[model samples]
Target: MTNEFVLEAITREFPESVLLSSEPYGMLTVEIKKDDIKKVIHYLKDSSLEINFLTDICGIHYPEHPAQEIGVVYHLHNMMTNFRIRLKAFMTREDTEIDSLTDLYAGANWMERETFDFYGIKFKGHPDLRPILNMEDLGYHPMLKEYKLEDGTRTDKNDAMFGR
Candidate 1:
């Protein structure tokens, strides 16, 4: 149930798949190849580790790191031991595909769709993959870092009222 126990378990079981491992805020976080994410999660859910709860699935954007421009983070919880762990898999903008976890966790459907809606990450093998939050015609992932932070064309209001 300790962080070291979970870290050692995952690294020992998936030596090559684990790209990086760290304990932040006393939680075990492991970064692995995007291709091996499904396999790794399957093992963690079904193995003795008993990390059975899929707490959340979210996306991250790192525009500065072209090689890893997009990332998916999985948060898992073990009810028996009250233990938790974080798994991350990142890929480039050119290849933004990762296996769907819906088969393993039904709750993944909505979470995956939300991630896709905002981050444009395609979840392969998802039964229904489409925008769950944004409009289908939005045409772009809003969470990506390339977009402007504010609307430069807004000039209707007074500059002093808007602090411009």
Candidate 2:
């Protein structure tokens, strides 16, 4: 029922899948291999752990770490006990393909598309994997750290109104 108990259950089940485990702010978070993400999530949903709710699926950009430049975070919740845990899988920019969770969680369709639109992380097996927010021909992922944070050339808005 506790975070430690849930963590142990997962670790015991998939020792090799878990690369790292941590608890920050009392919430359990585990980093797993991208190849084993679907299997691990399936176990969490079907096993006694009962982490059936998919709260959110988002992408993260850590440009400094070349090996883990792009990461996907899956937030899962157990409605019965109100327990929550996070699963993360990271890959390099060149290798951004991840298994889609649409089969396991119907709601993952939109989330996966959004992650793809922003982080350029492709979701394999996604029914209609395309941009949910961004245009189809954007040509670049805006959420990546490689892009500039602000447009210095822009002078249309007032500095005071924009808090600049």
Candidate 3:
């Protein structure tokens, strides 16, 4: 139930799938190879660790890192012991698709959709992959770093009033 124990179990189970690992803020965070993410998560769920809760799934865009420009982060929790862990997988911009976890965790359906809606990271095998919070015609992933943080053309509001 300890972080070290869980980390050791995962490393032992999949030696090559783990790219990097760390314990930040006392939480075990592991960066896994993109292709093996689904397999790694499957092991964590079905193994003795009993880490069964799927807390969240989200996407990240690191524009500066060409080889690993897009990433997916998964947060899992073990309600029995209140232990938690995080897993991450990254890929290049050209390939933003990753295996869907819906087959493993039913709750992943919406999370994967939301990640796709905001980050354009497709979830392969997702039963219904579409925008959950955004309009279908928006045509772009708003959360990517390439988008501007603010509308520079806006003239209705004065930055002086906001102390900007």
Candidate 4:
């Protein structure tokens, strides 16, 4: 169906869970409540819309926004209709845990692990939540903006050659 139809359906079903709605690059983007994310996604997949494909799940870090510093983004697709939707849930840095989607989509297990590994966002019900790419003892999420871009202690590199 059309984007408006899907948007209206979701808002009607979970009025309180939807915080904001937008169409970026012609894709339906919805900002859902952090705690209600799993519920909303389950509805979207099981309802008449048939948005069953879990395309991707990733984490985002926005250091400038304190209250909503950490976020998770879910991309869902209706393979039959060729329609897609995006859902985002944001939480504070101190409380980075959100309900796991592995119960709904089995493929979510690895994606959740990767998100946790990179952004340090914990999936509450994830069975085996661990680092997927980084070493377990790395101690910090490298994808966060808090880390410096370059190592200041390195003196062998010539900044002038790179126009720094």
Candidate 5:
């Protein structure tokens, strides 16, 4: 069962999406254009793909990389085809807002909140996007490569740990 429908939906709905691959990974990912996420998720769920099983969602931080701050990752499973894939979306600390997929996958509820906890990324329409872990006032994302010191200083923790 080729998921051409999801591809069509994405192409028709989001011609601006940075297409990653075709067929196998056709509806796998959309590079997370940030804005069209809702549309893409909805299309995937409604199309033949029916990737409704939101396995998990997490965010990674790489301060040294070109895309610093946050990298949201989504793991989806297709029950019909028994296929799984990891979708990644990058967002900077300054621009931490992305479309929500809760409407398509209810499992995204806590996962989205979890991502918000560590990365400060905001998932719009997540019902209650509150901190599930860590202190509420902790605005600094601890997962990034540029973790700050306790004295409110922006120094690389890795360097300090290794005695740089």
Candidate 6:
């Protein structure tokens, strides 16, 4: 099943937030408004979508274009249909806070922690919003383009061509 009914419901609920919807392949990609991310996430999980599993969440920082500050990717899996729905949340440093999905998916505990750890995003409701992989003292967000060193060591394609 393509879950058109679920998609319809989401479309009606978040007409503006939903950036793309492909019914043919049973795929729905929604760009969630920062404040409404949890609303859409809960709907997708509780609704007929059966997207119980929160597979992953990743943060993207594009310093080159200030318009794209933080992009959070959510991978949701529908166990019943074995289909996946991708939800995205684009935020900027000025607005680095987003609703927490921990209540919807218990598994999001670690993923959200990791996202906060690296990208410096704040999960509003995360019980213990702390670093997961990085050390406690690590203050800077190394993933951001602004963290790149003047030495240009972060991006050196020459290593691949020189073979050393």
Candidate whose TM-score is highest: 4
Candidate number of the best lDDT:
4
Please provide, for model 3 over 1-164, each residue's C-alpha lDDT reduced to its tens digit, 9 standing for 90 to 100.
89889988988989999899999999999999999999999998998888999999999999999999999999999899999999999999999999999999999999999999999999999999999999999999999999777699999978899899
Query: TM-score of predicted model 1?
Result: 0.93
Mind giving the per-residue lDDT tens digits that candidate 2 earns over 40-59? Answer: 99999999889999999999
Give me the displacement of residue 130 in model 1, in angstroms: 0.6
Off by over 4 Å in 6: 3-6, 20-27, 149-160
lDDT of 2 at 20: 93
**TM-score: the better of candidates 2 and 5:** 2
User: Lowest summed lDDT over 10 consecutive residues: which window, candidate 5?
Assistant: 21-30
Q: If both were scored by TM-score, which would come out higher, candidate 4 or candidate 6?
A: 4
- Writing each residue's lDDT as its tens digit, candidate 4 over 38-138 gives 99999999999999999999999899999999999999999999999999999999999999999999999999999999999999989999999999999
Provide the overall lDDT of each model, using Cα atoms, as 2-decimal numbers.
Answer: 0.94, 0.94, 0.95, 0.96, 0.71, 0.79
**Would you estimate the TM-scores of all the predictions?**
0.93, 0.92, 0.94, 0.95, 0.73, 0.82
- How much lDDT does candidate 5 score? 0.71
Q: What is the lDDT of residue 146 in candidate 4?
A: 96
Residue 62, candidate 1: alpha-carbon lDDT: 93
- Which lDDT tens digits does candidate 5 get at residues 1-164? 44454555567766886446443434455465656666766666776667778888888877766554567877777897876555667766678788878877777888988888877788887899989988888877666667445544656545568577
Model 4 lDDT on a 0 to 1 scale: 0.96
Candidate number that wins on lDDT, 4 or 6: 4
| Model 6: pairs clashing at backbone N, Cα or C within 3 Å | none
**Model 2 ranges with Cα > 4 A deviation:** 153-164
Candidate 6 C-alpha error for residue 94, in Å: 1.4
lDDT of 1 at 33: 91
